[model samples]
Target chain A: MNAPPMLEARGITRLLGEPPVQVQALKGVTLSLQPGELTLLMGPSGSGKTTLLSIFGCILAPTEGELKIAGKSTKGMTAEQLAELRRSSIGFIFQAYNLFPTLTAEENVMLALDVRRKAVTNPRQTAREALINVGLGHRLKSYPSKLSGGERQRVSIARSLIGDPSIILADEPTAALDGVNGKAVMELLSKISLDTSRSVFVVTHDSRILPFADRIVRIEDGNIVSDVRQKRA
Target chain B: MVYTLALRNFIHDRISLIVTLVGIVFSVVLMAIQIGLYYGSQQVITGMIDHSNAQLWITPIGAQSFDDSAFLKGGEKYAALSRPGVASATDVAVNIMAWKRADGGQQAVVLVGTDSDDKSLMAWNLIEGSVADMYKPNAVIADKAYLADLQVKGVGESGEVNGRKAVIVAITDHIRSFTTLPYLFTTLSRAREFMQLGPNQSGFVIVRVKPDASVAAVRADLQKNLRDVDVLTNEEFRDRSVHHWLFATGAGAALIAGAVLGLIVGVVVVAQTLYASTKDHLNEFATLRALGASAGYIHRVILVQAVLSAIIGYLIGMAEAFAVNWATRDTQLVMLITPGLALALFLITLTMCIFSAIAAIVKVTRIDPAMVFSR
Candidate 1:
């Protein structure tokens, strides 16, 4: 009871497009994500999965409903405050493996540390340690262009883990990876959640990942049709 | 850190950076050359008036420049000496006449007539020979620059001026007039006789003021005392001499037009180059913004980059100007590139770069981070 859920969404709703032709992207979705939880959000294409992920990641705000992190409601928060919250409390792993090409793999992760406003001494060393945790210790100095697709995603994961945030939100991280590398990346995320108590929220359309999640929420056309934690068998 | 980023970014666009540097080099070199020639021409025009030993000149009514010839009916020497501020006064006679050269050619000269006794003001800047020889009846002084044109054999050489035998008694430095013509200094009696007039004819009444006297007060008193006569300080005369030479034709207009054209070309080149570079890097800047860099941070990077480029380019350009100056030190075309002139050019170049950089920034700031994901 002393450790509250790291992420909570209460009746979250959002609309896209201008008035008179508004398209509802999310319809009053509610969820609580505790530390050590590995959750998967599965939906067909155009089912508002990405919209829900962006709202939870603080990159986009919901038009209605309260979103809270560590029991603090994110109401009337300024843009700077949201950025600060993202920097301090949440880590994001994009599907594109958005590593700046000009920087080395280690420096790519170190940039996350820089944006987090942390007073880390020797960011390269910290970045190397994070990479080693994700099994990319030897590829620290390689540029993003030099790394393979799997290694690039590992670097992205290292970048997200560099800030040691309470929750990690990943959007389609495995969509670009092949089966073997994708499975490897998913295993890494599960290990991070169990070993470090960092709640991991992943949005994916791949059914292969459903077995790996502690809970699975299924969405169709923008509404959650089923929320199940485990197989009945 | 932002400086480091800007430098790296600049290095990335090596070709653009080189083009920008070349533009600045051309601008700075042109500005230096233009300013040097402008000031050099001014010096040439005002050199004689600046070096003259006279404190003031008194001419006929409303004449501010020496070209406005005035006639005094008498040897106003005593009349000027009687003034309260006058230290000494002498009658001067000036005439324009042709002198025979050794080459059998005739060169026009301003024949300046001064008293042989007033050696202090008679060919005072003697580069060669002696000013004291003016005591000789038909002796004349010429400027060293006109030595080849006059084709005089040597000192004591004779030449015919106004149908009278004139000896090359001495050569003086900086005796050339604003018209780029040579002046021949002669004794007052000879000049008066050569340029025939009534017995009382005098071209100007020179006046000298005491060190303790106020120049303004002196000028006012003299203008009042000598009714219908013009009186001016030495500085005013120098200004008028320069102005007269500058405005005589359309030369000043041409020089000014050239400078203005150079400025326009420089601003356009820098602005266009930077703007193009910005457009090419729109994606890169959007990526940086998406990575949490603030607008202010991006602006700092651009501004610092422009300043660095300006400084490097200006220094290289100034070095080129100095090379030109050193190459032409002995030539008549004075390439006087002063530090003040170089500094002014640098400031102007920097301002143009800043304006151009701001233009680039305006285009850059309009790029939204969403563009990185979409386009």
Candidate 2:
């Protein structure tokens, strides 16, 4: 039997803003992100790409429809419950490399377990191991301000990988990097997906990284325009 | 790691953090000084009553404060002594007298006179001579703080009180009263002679209750028997005196109002700085939320930061306040920071900072975690 999709959204609709000025950012968008696949959500500004990513990341709840993670429905869950599920089943990567400048790379990665509210045994070792997996073993003690953009992004990726969640949601992960750095980051992400059987959903407009994605989904005006599977470089 | 992050954020930027710390310290010190000044003023206003060991006091009827009293009816001590709970009763005299300065200037002085053997009311902190020296002929004790006002350089300098010949036999320090006038200490009879009152006349009577007697019962007996005088326990008299000079008079009202205003201003200042410091890290807070941090976790982080700031700020602030208190110990502006007051200030600071974190909390809770996706 085929395994269920790691992250799936059905008829996801979201309204932004207040009455008389509300924005229908998403309308009946359905997508399934599978294990061992790097899926890219591509669209222009105001095209509901981030909104869809936010709903999938459990950061925002849809106005209608359901989000299922590992075949478990996320309907009627409180914000805190959604947060718990987000920590346990999903990982997030921001475009700005949102590592706390005050915290060193290792501490930033360990923050994942801190949010879990569960007693983690030797979390430092776990965080160190994750950073090592991301090729940042030598930069464990470096703060975000002390590291370059690529290194900071890598630290962020390490932070997302800390809990080994089934789904990883990345928003413009390579938007701030140069060609060489972006290529290296995409190659690393592609390798992570192929090696770990974890679903990696990337929301980006950077077409340069398209060669590394297993599938490409294009969106416009809050609707999916095209979706195609591709071969990696 | 949470505490480490909080502390790191607190100490991250030396200049801005120093500025914030300076603001916190300034608010704390301001509040301490204001409160201390009010407390010191109240203490000075009731110094005689507080220092006295008398179990009960007999002042003329309608006496508002120790400084504001009429002469007691004659035979007050005898009436008090005849009371059932009375152990011993002694007459005392208190009146503001004119001091003939050696500078050919005139200064008003409050002369407090009890028995030379009276331990109830006596000169304290005598730096130059013993209290026994108060028994010497024409001898009186004067505080060195007002030595210049008394127009004398030091002890043994002769001065005149109400045109009577008196000599300073001892020097004291910080023996000031509410009226901001110098106090001269001498024997009760000597003071009576200086004032030229009748032989049996005294301003008030100091009564001590028997060891087996309850002060309240003794006070009731003395009040019932002494018909022309108001009998009160020492604590009652001290409180009455403090109430009169602390909240009754115009100066007293002004001082209390000033202290309260200072405290409010201090709260605003500390709150603003604390809120600004929290707001300074909004981006990081949003980032944490985007990283799947729970609301409670974010709350803990912010509150931890506030608590850290409050504790550090309170310590440094109180240290500065104590330094100022010590610096002004010999001066007229005495700052009293009791242990109770210190604890209160600490709790107030901590509570204010924690409340200040609420603004940041509300903002962070409403932040769109998806902003991390946008430019």
Which is the leading candidate under DockQ? 2
Tens-digit per-residue lDDT, A1-233, candidate 1 = 25688989998889988999999989999888878878899989889888887777666788999999877778899655766677777777777777766678887787777767678888778989999999998899899899988899999889888878888888888988899999999988888878445899998978777778888888777788888786311
Residue-wise lDDT of candidate 1 within B245-362, one digit each (tens)? Answer: 5665656556666666667767777777778876776765665555555566667778877887789888998899899888865444555677778788889889978877889899
TM-score result, candidate 2 = 0.94
Residue pairs in clash, model 1:
none
Please report the candidate that would top TM-score against the real structure.
2
lDDT, each prediction: 0.76, 0.82
Which CAPRI quality tier does the interface of model 1 achieve?
incorrect
Per-residue lDDT of B1-375 in model 2, one digit per residue for the tens? Answer: 678877888888677567656756776787788788878887887787777778888898878777763677578887777778788888888887889988777899888788766687888888899888888998889998888888888867887887877899999888887777888989988988877767777888889988999998888777777687888878888888887777776666776576566456545655666567667777777777766788888878878877887788889999999999999888866668999989988887788667766776777678766666667
The TM-score obtained for chain B of candidate 1 when compared with the true chain B: 0.83
Model 2 backbone overlap count: 0
Name the regions of candidate 1 deviating beyond 4 angstroms.
A1-233, B52-78, B88-208, B238-250, B327-332
